[model samples]
Target: MAKMVDQNPLKFSKYIKTYYGISFVEFLNRLKIHYFLTHVDHVDQFTLETYIYQSGFANRSTFYVAFKKYVGVNPSFYLKELKGK
Candidate 1:
């Protein structure tokens, strides 16, 4: 997700130090958001299942759980909102 900040230097940099006291799980959640938004256009469960498998998540269920916890919404909902935009 480093590329997300590289492309939006100012906006991302603002949060660089804000995660200092956060938990590792929270950090992972942040990365998940960046990953989701950056890859929203290419997302497909079969593909994501392959990609996220290596991230220590056994399956989409776990990933979605953490994703919803931090994002306050499911990826499908986020995608729907983006489409409306």
Candidate 2:
């Protein structure tokens, strides 16, 4: 899709930033984070760390940051909140 618009990734990323008010990386990160949130529970995980990597986050910190940014809480807090409900 990006190629159809601009052959250069840098230019296409710039256009995404110009229009979306965020860098393309942010856009992709948010999408990945949301996908993780929706599917994280349904998927079997032998370890939380494994799930984090499988969800497309490079590491736990990156996942935590994105989770906090979008969900307004870190994963641990979010899990606690879920338990309270």
Candidate 3:
């Protein structure tokens, strides 16, 4: 990212931390989670596995941890909530 932006990597990470109040990895994870939630519709257990990788998560456990951290609910329950709305 710093290479792409012509920035020093350390400086760039510092900027992200200051600006976003999160580390660069956290920012990227949040972006990935946001992408998955907004792009997926009609989510199911089988398809959730697919979308986990599609959202750039390496596996279900990591995705579940990140989802629970940021979204405040598991994906399945979140989908159910969305469906209720």
Leading candidate by TM-score: 3
TM-score of each: 0.52, 0.77, 0.86
Instruction: State each model's CA lDDT, in order.
Output: 0.65, 0.79, 0.88
List, residue by residue over 1-85, the lDDT tens digit for candidate 3: 8999999999999999999999998988899999998877746545778888889999899888889999999987988888888
Please give the distance, in angstroms, between residue 51's alpha carbon in candidate 2 and its true position after superposition: 1.7
Model 1 steric clash pairs: none
Q: After superposition, how far is residue 64 of candidate 1 from its true place, in Å?
A: 1.3
Better of 2 and 3 by TM-score: 3
Residue-level lDDT of model 1, residues 55-79, one tens digit each, is: 5566788778887887789867876
lDDT-best of 1 and 3: 3
Q: Candidate 2: which pairs clash? A: none
Q: After superposition, how far is residue 76 of candidate 1 from its true place, in Å?
A: 1.6
Give candidate 3's error at residue 20 in angstroms: 0.7
Better of 1 and 2 by lDDT: 2
* RMSD per model, one decimal: 7.9, 2.4, 1.9
**Best by the lDDT measure:** 3
